[model samples]
Target: MTRSLKKGPFVDYHLLKKVRSSDVLNKRIIKTWSRRSMIIPEMIGFTFAVHNGKNFIPVFVTENMVGHKLGEFSPTRVFKGHSGDKNSKNLKGSKNVVRKK
Candidate 1:
């Protein structure tokens, strides 16, 4: 569900303050744990280190990311892929198959 338009976008006060205090030309990464905070226009051109449970992931904010949640860029889960090696064994045996060139 989306936030109520009347309440406005949910931008963390502390995060905003940090962005304002830092110089954009310095290229310093602003570390933050507030993944739920929404990205605003003011955050453009700044790099953010958003916490993803175990570690912080770097998220470079651009104009296209405006209005999106910070968490959307930082993934929480590590995809190890599906179980079973049956497909791999079959593929190895089929290497001799003729190909349409």
Candidate 2:
């Protein structure tokens, strides 16, 4: 039976049940899969590439991995500038903003 669960975002119980029933998920015992799964990797990958470069710079793609506007709230280095004054301000006139240890 489908049981409605109020996870952070709207998650359907049937879907959760199906995922839990799956061998892979059950084996791993994933209690509450976060929405960051797809995004975190991309951000890390971008960070890695930047770190490797002579001048590590954040480059926020205009669109996210899904090809839609990456929300200003979304953690990314690349700024679309179009995201508005705030986003543009967040990524002002410098490409090589150094990171602190």
Candidate 3:
């Protein structure tokens, strides 16, 4: 479920303060751990260093990214491949097989 329309978008007060005080954009990266906080128009053009559990990843907020969560830009999990041996005979279909001469 999304946030109630009556409450309005949830932007961290501290973050808003930091952003409001700064006038430069793309010059400094704002380091923050508020991944759950929603992105606002004031964040546009600013680059943020959002923490992804282990380290901080740079995230540049644009007009298109407004109303989205900070965490969406900084992914936490790494996608590996599916399990199983490539040479296993149990593999489906023998499309690449050739008959012995």
Q: Which wins on lDDT, candidate 1 or candidate 2?
A: 1
What tens-digit string does per-residue lDDT give for candidate 3 at 1-101? Answer: 88898999987898989899997643788999999889988889899999999999999888999999999999999989788787775545666666678
Which is better, 2 or 3, measured by TM-score? 3
Which portions of model 3 show Cα errors greater than 4 Å?
Answer: 89-101
Candidate 1 Cα misplacement greater than 4 A, ranges: 87-101
lDDT per residue for candidate 1 within 1-101, as digits (tens), equals 88899999998899999999998899999999999999999899999999999999999999999999999999999999878977776774687777789
Candidates ranked, most accurate by TM-score first: 1, 3, 2
What TM-score should be assigned to candidate 1?
A: 0.84
Q: Which stretches of candidate 2 lie over 4 Å from their true place?
A: 1-7, 25-101
For TM-score, the strongest prediction is 1
lDDT of 3 at 83: 89
Report the C-alpha lDDT of model 2 over 1-101, residue by residue, as the tens digit.
32244433333354345444555322332322222222222232222112212333333322244322223223435566654465555665677677688
Using lDDT as the measure, the top candidate is: 1
Candidates in order have lDDT scores of 0.94, 0.34, 0.89
